[model samples]
Target: MAGVLHRAALRTSRLLQCSKRPSRYHNGSLFFSTSSRRPLMALTGFTETQLTVRDAVSQVCSQFPNTYWQEHDENERDPTDFHATLAKDGWLGIALPEALGGSGLGISEATMMMQAIAESGAGMAGAQSIHANVYATQPLAKFGTAEQLESTIPNIISGRCRVCFGVTEPNSGLDTLRLATAASKQPDGSYRVTGQKIWITCAQVAAKMILLARTTPLEDVEKPSEGLSLFCIDLDRSKHSGLDMRRIKKMGGRAVDANEVFFDNYAIPADSLIGEEGQGFKIILHGMNAERCLLAGEALGLGYAALARATQYAQERTVFQRPIGMNQGIAHPLAEAYMRLEAAKLATYHAARLYDDGSVPAADVGVACNSAKYLAAEAAFAACERAVLTHGGMGYAVEYDVERYFRESLVPRIAPISREMILNYISEKVLGLPRSY
Candidate 1:
């Protein structure tokens, strides 16, 4: 298995190198060469297996049209049917181990699945509706004991269970080490948790929660990051009577719910603990690089979809005797957006390759992941804005569909991690500067 993965990684690298060279064929046609100079296929950095997964996902996405997404957007309804279809098709477990009823694919395949979904014009709403199942329990897969893994992973992989992450807090913000959410040990070996969490996605529909809480006071711990623990607790709304869930109104991605969650002395069984005591922060950080890479791919897909729409509109719309694409003002921005999207896509794929190959250290992967995500978010936003501008008045009109992309593109820039936070990461970690925040 390791050998196969390495060969795939090598092929992916070569494909990326080939893609960077200028294409010899004109008019957007792929050219072949007799002497090892053929132009690389676009999006070719993905391995053959990855490509197969992408094609399969694309095939599924093709069944849903722009009209379908438009209706869903207008109604602010969940894509329960779509989610069920994916679950039935075994897509929800794309990254889980095969023994647990999943295909045991890596992040590359999962990223491609998300990218395909967004590129189909469904945007973040489509991806987020099914994203949590893809990799939300990676820590459990990697760190949980055999018995724990047997109990937790299969239910999630099979879509029989839904889990929401609880990391961000209202007061703590990104300063995770300073979180005040306390989980005190009880006489019965369980823990009583008390805290409030903000901006938790999909909480309203989740049956379980991957929670992080302070197990020891900051002053008593050797480091602020220590004394933190993770729990895969059952969100038994009845037993935890103090637990409160309130949905938040959001600018976009309305199909996937987001909420503020409050916990008041919620009791979680001792068996729910994910790993060794006082190690929640480390476990949570383990998934950050993968999360960033996935987000970058999703953002790249949105940019591609927006650019495709703009290009189509430009070619079809006529003014003053010719297609509007004949004008440089309208055409140049779309072209530039395409180039930016390509650049971001390449960065994201490269980061994924490095991660999969283990060629880069875990900490360095964070830098690469942040770079890819920041670039992709910026590129996607630019492409969506240009798409709307290209459509002129029709863009703002909900009927045109560009406005939906414009609204949805704003999400990748603001959530999970923000542009400012990425900048701070690069400054402090990459450049060895003092922490800004």
Candidate 2:
């Protein structure tokens, strides 16, 4: 198995011919190493670091092929084995600081890893199963105290501690400012959190959670974004009386559990509070750029996977004594999808590159990240739809796997943030338009 993985890693790494070029691009300004010949088939012109991340993740994912992912999805089970594989291999900390027992990589590298896994036919289920390790755990490293970091980061780096995020509210929906979950201050300075959180991924199995609640009342606070606080707390299932959880069945991504949780008088220690009080929004926002970039990469990968499947079927499945790929009806959509995915890929990686650059402004990063998410999600959905259409009846079959991809593809379009919200952001922030209702 080791030898097979090594050879596969080498072969997969050869997918892109990246010349000796320094890859760094600002918001729109690109800087490339001078080479008369460009890297053939290099869509985003990845650097050596990004290429290594992509190849390593692809090699790991190669072990769990479509059958593995499809089975987990069909059974509605968590991809715990796959998650363990990645954690054991230290892929969980691909972007973590080296001192924290991670690879000390950047979001760009993490993006490559996710895209590689998704493209390897694991789809969203495979990538998202461990997505929190990279994106959702950012608060710990950025805002956690030294004591918290020492106690927490390593467990997460290993497979010992799995985490989920709890921020969305059933009533608030995307209006985070209007969330009603309250964290009352106890006499001992601890917090007694009582609220309902929904759409929390991995809640069914997570040992920890990054929770956000109103430590101070919204009416008392000057700003709604204020009065919000962040907590990294233990999701002790034994606390059944305090913490109640129920799995939410969905159209896709069944391999991972999404749950609606109720926290009734969930006691949180003072030490579990991250950063300053009433600054949860800022702390959470610190990780949003990375999250958006990584999510975009996942979306781009799913698009590529769907396109690859459709193209393969077009080539091998003959019709009227000719390959369907030779027909314009079958070929054009795939070709169009390729272009769309390529465009989205460029935007996704560009956002990652921008975020990796420390000199870039925060405002620029927000615009780039939002735009990348929007484009990548849109392209991925379109490609999956085309793949389904190309497959016709076979596409709907479980064995074909396009239906799974199609179902999973909707995740990006509707998750983390909606396409409508993203558009509103761009209109207000980038285009300088008045905010729409």
Candidate 3:
């Protein structure tokens, strides 16, 4: 397995370098020289597999300019065309199984795809437009009935259907085991679900959902993690009798919509249930580690993008008739940003490898995932800050594009998981200290 992985990585690297070399026939330079050259070498030290994935994604993303992303963000519209293009090209299903109509690639490839998207100047807006569809179906893929998986996976892979995750709630926050949503089994063997979910990414546009609700009362269940059930249900907006979705306006990633979803006696077929009833929590937990690692990859990309932009601007912008990059004050921060991002990138790829191998224990992957996410988030934040400082007043301006990366960088630090929770995981899980929360 290790040999196979190594070979895969090497092949991917060769393909990446081949794909990314600029065409000599082009009339004009495709990108600013400094920023264009920086990402190639800066990210090359990571796994060849990751670099290959990044290069492929970057090649595809280069078609969409910064102006395209800015327009999408300004209009607060999802980049449906961009997403459909990816879906058509089979990029959206890069991590899914080949039998299920995906490219049959692994999470490592998917992370590189996302990272490259963000690094190409699309930022979170471009990435999140298709993020949920990339990996949110893991529960169904892994634990759903064969019939269920067959019915659902292909449509999602084809981009004919969209799914959103329903996990976080207003009351419970990150204490996922304490969620209050309830699903009662009726005489006809259907589930009547009633609950509210917050921060459901892309819910407003989703046609389906991977939902979790308590099937058995917490007190009645022996384990707190038991009694919770996972479901893959229809989010039929026209049948508004039971489901209500209120779009939440967010500070960044505006091109993709997030929402607060309320379910009141939403009727779903018993077959909609994923895996075993009362095992929903465990099923969902199966994907959380991968999600964190992927987010780290995304953060790593954003950090590299910011650092590349800052370094380029410093080289071109004049100060006292000299390039600002000539001074240590500006040069040192860019170097620091590079170091931090590289460190986080290493952790993210290591976590990805563990996940792909399945040899490491689950607890170990969880800790590593959290560590990657925390480090990547911090690194991305620092890089964006430095980018802003390096660009001076122009960074604050929208046309320069640094501010967009800066704002979008904050989402990864705050969402999916927070830095505080990541530290708590490390302190308790890695050090064997008492739980902090």
Ranked candidates (TM-score, high to low):
3, 2, 1
Q: What is the C-alpha RMSD of each candidate to the true structure, in Å?
A: 6.1, 6.4, 3.9
lDDT of 1 at 437: 76
List runs of model 3 lying over 4 Å from the truth: 1-49
The estimated TM-scores of all candidates read: 0.89, 0.91, 0.92
TM-score of 1: 0.89
Q: Give the higher-lDDT candidate: 1 or 3.
A: 3
State which candidate, 1 or 2, has the greater lDDT: 2
Per-model lDDT:
0.78, 0.83, 0.80
Please, what are the lDDT tens digits per residue for candidate 3 over residues 1-437?
Answer: 23323444565566556547753211011233523532332545566555656655666677788888888888888888888877766677777777777766677878878888888788888888877787678767889888997898888877888888899999999889999999999999999999999999888778889998999998998888999999999886766669999999878888889899999998999999998899888889777877887788788777877777787688789989999999999999888888898888888888887887778898888887788889999999999999999999999988877888899999989879788888888888888999978
Superior by TM-score: candidate 1 or candidate 3 = 3
lDDT of 2 at 122: 87
Model 1 stretches astray by more than 4 angstroms = 1-41
Candidate 1 positional error at 105, Å: 1.5
